[model samples]
Target chain A: MAEAFLRRHTPELFGLATLLVCVLGFEALIRGGVVNRYIIPPPSDILLAFERVIVEENILARCRDTAFEMLVAGGASVLVGVPIGVLLYRSALWRRAMEDWIGALAAAPIVLAFPLFLVLFGRSPKTIIVMGFVHGLAPIILKTVEGLASTRPVLINVGRSLKMTQSQMFWKILLPSAMPIIFTGIRLSWTFVLITIVGIEYLINLGGVGQLINELAERYDLPGTYAGICFVILVSVLFFLALERVESWLQPGR
Target chain B: MSISEKTSLAQEPALVVDDVVKRFGRGTEIVTAVDHVSFTVRQGEFVSVIGPSGCGKSTLFNIIGGLLSDYEGAVKIGEERISAPHPAVGMVFQEESTFPWRTVIDNVAFPLELQGVAKSERMDRAHHFIDMVGLASFEKAFPSQLSGGMKQRVSIARILVSQPKILLMDEPFAALDEQTRLLLGDKITQIQQELNQTTLLITHNLTEAVQLSDRIVVMTYRPGQVKRIVDINLPRPRTSDVVGSDAFGHYVAEIWNDLREEASRGMADSESAASRRATHG
Candidate 1:
């Protein structure tokens, strides 16, 4: 029974053990003065700093603010992106005219447009949300178009054989068939949205864990700075987990 | 009138495919797929159209099932001429067609749902057909969970639930193994006999065609044209058990001889086309 348990969890056990060794090794290096403690604090110091930062810097509020911005930006992107995708799929002329432009938009440095957004929406969370929304929109639209376009011809023929109307075909067959790909687009969209939101927060020092990290870095509090960055990593992990849950819920078969 | 007279009157033609000519491309690049093919399926009859690959059997099927509209053909079910999908015709496709997102019962009930049948009524009918296809307990199972043969059975049940006047199958069992094909063929035969259904099957497998069909329409190679229609004089209510009989072997041999010539001609045509491309290149 013990052997079976170890066999089932070998990768996880090995990964955790490796992580512990690395942390202990780094701590010893810092204590032995081989590495500069001023620049790279020991893992123990970073862990100790977590409690201080969480209590004093109001880390939970920062996390909540970042999560809220992510939620709003992600939701808006999906609401606007999916319909645009369906539109592009339905209209070949529109798709031919706009598809290249959308591709260009996806490749462009969308974060650089933060100043324009600040001028338009002002120095607030609104600016950050809008930037994230713009950054995330293109992938959702493109993936939606691709997903709908890639539905198998045989499946369409099945719908045609049943004498399904155009609207019925879109609703019953095309949309459901395109869903897995569309979910891929949504996951990608969320990643971009999260990066944009946190980056904008750090850049302007307005809200969220990005602002907290900027403040700690300026104060030269190495342990606190690293702790703030850890919170950012935590936020990303949380969003990823949430997205996976929703995806599985939506597509139980997969 | 007596019961015999009424039974004779009921044996009228259910489906007619007259002079179907489907051509692809335009002008200099023109290629004809199906060429003026004609056949009729009577009520309560099983007909198979057999041929080599690329013989436009699929094109003919698409036209009959109303998937392809740019064909010069008249496909009639009962008194109505069909250029588009008709309510009286149901088609079973060759590929994996059971919608991955739906359970077996839901997939089977899709047509009835489209026709605005009540949920309870459609579910009951779907259950009946699912049971008929030997997938009774698997009604709640998704397409992803089933094997290839089981998925095909789900599709079969889906088509059967609609209860159309005629069932048009396009190489439906061509993807299965020999044993699964024979077993499914037997199940299909049983269903047809039980329902007294009119069916038109498009296949390249001579054994499958001979096993399931009351009459076989053999077609030539590309630019597919009907070469002959051989009547199967085998007894009714037949199953795969008759496959070992001498008559079944003779029928298979006869169809194989007819198909062997066309298959070779098809191979030759492809070979020459390849050589022509290689020379030009």
Candidate 2:
């Protein structure tokens, strides 16, 4: 019967088995004192902390803070980045001047400039959101430029042949043509924003789930720290699910 | 504008390209594409521009279509000079130019949308043209969902919706198979006759030029210049069956004779260029 089940559900069975091995190994290492419990708490203790964080502690509030920061940063990135991308697409001089800079900025550690951001925006969620926005901006701008630039010249010629105005050509032909690529950029930017928001919260000791995790670690509450990290993971999963739903809702077909 | 307005505008040639010259690069490296090429299409005439490969037929077409304005001389639609794209001139490209994001009906309605035509009215007209193209069954299908020919049909419908007086087709069927090309040629003939659309088709296919054009303007190799203008004088309501006729064979033979020398010249030039690259590299 076990062999029959394994053949039918190999993928699921293998995945569960791998996870079980990990949990059991961790538990064994803890019981044998091969691993320090203070640094890496046992699976049972972490699971117990997860229950307490949900039922006893108000982890939802911190989750809400992180979610809100992500929204603000992601929204600002799109609003600012897309227009700048379009600007780069329109002007050859601007594109020549900024293209390399944009690429470099995207790969740079802009999240580390949180101290300057805090100095500018203060030690509030404002600084964290701003940092997130700045970190996310480059990918959105670069992608937008790429998407618009890569529109088939044949389509533009068709538009011109139809005597469409510049604005009309942009909205009707260019925008729709560039949409898939632009959305890819937006997704990338959303990821960057989420990372920046969480990282900033952890680094500067601001609000959000990141700060909670930081506090738990500082207090040497190993299980609580693990549970807080799990909360961050849950936030990320929910955020990604929501992003997928929104993307599908906006674009129906592949 | 209606047929009445078109008739009033018909006092002049539908389109004219006079002494148009286009060159690329700078100084000694400059290469002339279209060299003093001149042609005129009358009110409802179908003219095909035929040339050997590397001929500047496409450059000349672009000049007439106002896509390339940096040229000597003039291109006029009706009485007005075309320095930029005007509403009277519509171009059908050889490439897959349909918007893949839009459905057939929406693609057909695009020009009308640009003109801010009412949605219901534009859709009604789009549906009529879609049916004319025999793509009514797939009106809601996207370009990616359609065959190459169907997508071109959508492109044709889109251009027609804007009511351009002259249709400038740049080898529109060059990518399709021979069978599909001939079929589309027949459809285009029907559409041109029904709408009385003045068309200028650029093509490399002798059969296509002979089958569809009222007159075939044969062009010379590279720096393309008009060599001869052969009046088709074929009977109206031409179908693919017309190609089987004696006159069709005669026209095709004449065009082949006109093009044979130029085709050889073009081939020699390319072969020499390739050998030069082989040596230099």
Candidate 3:
């Protein structure tokens, strides 16, 4: 039993071990003057600076602001994107007309449009949120279309055989079947949203961990900058964990 | 006793597939899939449409089930002719149809839920069918946890719960191993006898047809037409045990004899098509 458990977790254990070795090796190299301390701080210094950055920079508030922006943007993207996707699925004309546009949107550097957003929404959290929303929307829409399209014809036939209404077919058959793929789109959207939000926060010198990283970097507080980046990582981890929970809740037994 | 009297032929016809002709493509590219096919499934009768691949059995099944509306045919369930999906006709697909997201009971109850049956009432009815399919203990189990055969049973129970007047099954056990297919065949026979379900099954499996059907409709190669209809003349409330009977052997051999030429023709057509593609490429 123990062996089986170990076998199951072998990759995770190995990953942790490799990470520990790299950290220790890097720490040793820096302390021994084999690497420059000014540019790249040792792992221990970065770890110790976490408390100082938290206390001095008010990192928690910045984390909260970033998280709030992310939540709004991510939520809005799903709310808007999913329906657009369903529309695309339901109407072939719309799909043909807009699918390539949506694909182009995904490929477009949406973060570069922050200036327009800033001008429209003002240089505030709204700009960051809007940028994140736009950045995230395309993937969710495309993935939703792809997911809905991938539903097995047999399943649709089953629904048709039952004489299910269009609404019933969408809710009971199509949505559930396409959910995993849609969740994948959500994950992709969240990643893009996080990246865009952080980039916008840093660019505009606004309120978020991104701004904290910027300030720490300007002060040449390398350890504190890394620590601030760690907090950003923390935000991402928390959101991903929450997303996983939601996905599992939505699709149990799968 | 005559075969008609024994097989309950006095009952009204539950389903009639009158001259179904389905074609694909258009103009120069047009290909006929099914042509001038007609059959009747009597109420409380289990009929199997046995045909080789490319013989358009699935096309016929789809037309009758209302999954394909563009076909040229009149598919009547009782008095009502249907060109689209009808509430009174339920179908079971050969592929895995159980929703992975739903529990066994929920999957079975889905049709009722669609019909706006109350939750408690649907759950009760779902449980009844779940028990009927012998998945009583696995009511809360998901489709992912069940074996292939078990999943098919769940799908069977699911379709049965809606209580459609006619059940159209498209090789519902074709994916299973030989043993599981026979076992499920017995289970389906039992279910049909219990519910007096008027069923029309589309399959290429001769043994499956002989085992589960009262009569078999054999179709010719593409532009598929009914070549022959063989009566089983076997007793009802039949089980897999009857598979060993001499009558069963005779029936299987007879169907195989009729099917051999059609099967070979289908194979030759496919091979020629493949070679044509090769040469064109």
Candidate 4:
């Protein structure tokens, strides 16, 4: 069975092998003392610290908080982004009016507005969430707009010939057709939202994965810092993998 | 025409076009894509529109299709003018209109679903047409899974389930290779003969026009107006072998001579615009 799976998925095996090599190489650099022990901890020490973090550090709660921010941000993006995309699809005039503005938003850095988010919301969960949402929303809106707008005129004509109501056309034709493109936005948003939440934690001194990593770093517990960093990487990869599975399941042809 | 004479064949039109004109752009530069062009597509007759590119043959089809409604003329089912699309006039675009999201069966079943037909009934209807298009086994296959010829077959199946009175095809075979185009053309002729379907096909392929059309309507380029309507005197039930005949060559030459200069100018304009775009970009 293992051999069969590998035979079917050769590229997957190669990618895993490469990732393992990088992890091993990073461990070797720390163990060999290529860098200061105070700065860079060995993987063995990191793993031991990781065991301790899992046992005592409320890993689930921090995860829940971060996940909460992501879910809210993702939901907000879908709600706002889909409608904006639909509106842009309604007319060439609307596309012309708002396309440049949307492009500008997609280009603008979220860090530039951190101070504003901080000032308005204060250093609370709301700040982190707002930050996550801010980072997350751009791609969703842009991709949704692109997806909905790019429907072939022929397909639309098919709908028209069917005597489909406007709402029916949107649900049955435009939305489904645009889904593959829209999923791209969601995928990018997930990563961006996670990064934004961590950034917010760092900037405002909130307690999450980002805050924990900062605290461990300040204490010079290189092993513990390594553990937190490793945890961050592990969680991020897991989140992305989960998102891919969901998107693939939802996309019929994929 | 009296109302009863017009309504002789139930709710469907015998050939309903009450002077339709489609315009593009605006102000002083407003280009009339389809000038007040009108023609009746008698039920069960194979009518073909031949012209150069951008001669608004496609634009005219779009208007009849109810895809473009901002036109100056009226299209009717019988006596009533149609301002929007209805399933009675199923269209197949020059490019494939098969839904990328759906399997062959589902794409074909789309019209039936819109009409609120039972799922089983629509599925049965879809399979019947799919079989007719020679894709019976690939009912569950997605549009992307099919080849160009197969994809167009699915597209044909999709329109067939609607049970449209008139089938409007806009260069459906233009994208295929010559071999596939000939094969599909034969297949189309056979299916239409079997179904007794009225079809209005638009194309630059004169051989196809001559082979399938009961009569061919040739039009002038830009501000597309009808140049002449020539009745195709060829025998019925045409096959690939029909193209090898003397009548076929004569028909092809006749159509080309009429359209040669226009076709050349259109090609030149296209090249220049493409070059300009490339340079500017």
Which candidate has the top score in TM-score?
1
Global Cα lDDT for candidate 1: 0.92
Q: Rank the candidates by DockQ, best first.
A: 3, 1, 4, 2
For residues B94-114, could you state the per-residue lDDT of candidate 1 as single tens digits? 998999988899999999999
Evaluated at residue B170, the lDDT of candidate 4 is 91
lDDT of 4 by residue, B1-281 (tens): 88897666533545677677888887998988877777777777788999999899888787778877788978877776766776678888887888888888998998888889999999999999999999999999888888999999988888888888889899999998988988898999999889879999989888889888888988888778777788888887778788899998998899888888778877887899999999999
| Global fold similarity of model 1 (TM-score) | 0.95
Among these predictions, the greatest lDDT belongs to 1
Candidate 2 lDDT over A1-254, as tens digits, reads 98899799999889989999999999999989999888799999999898777666678999999999998888899999999999999999999999999999889898888878888998999999888898899999999989999999999988887777889989988988898898899888888888889889999987998888888888888898899888888887887788788776655444
Candidate 2, residues B1-281, lDDT tens digits: the string is 99988776664577888888889999999998888888889888999999998889888878788888899988987577888877788888989898877788988998887778899999999999999888989998878888899889888888887778898899888889999998998999999999989999999999999999999899999888899999999999888889899999998998899999999999999999999999999
lDDT of 3 by residue, B1-281 (tens): 79888666546688888888899998899999999999888888899999899999888878888888997768887677788888788889989999999999999999898888999999999999999889999999999999999999999999999998888899988888999999999899999999988899999999999999989999998879999999999998799998999999999999999899999998998999999999999
Collision count of model 1 = 0
Specify the poorest-scoring 10-residue window by lDDT in model 2 chain A.
A245-254
The reply for model 3, stretches above 4 Å from the true place, is A1-14, B1-9
Off by over 4 Å in 1: A1-35
Question: Lowest-lDDT window of 10 residues in candidate 1 chain A?
Answer: A245-254
> What value does DockQ give for candidate 1?
0.77
Query: Which residue pairs in candidate 2 have backbone atoms (N, alpha carbon, C) closer than 3 angstroms, thus clashing?
Result: none
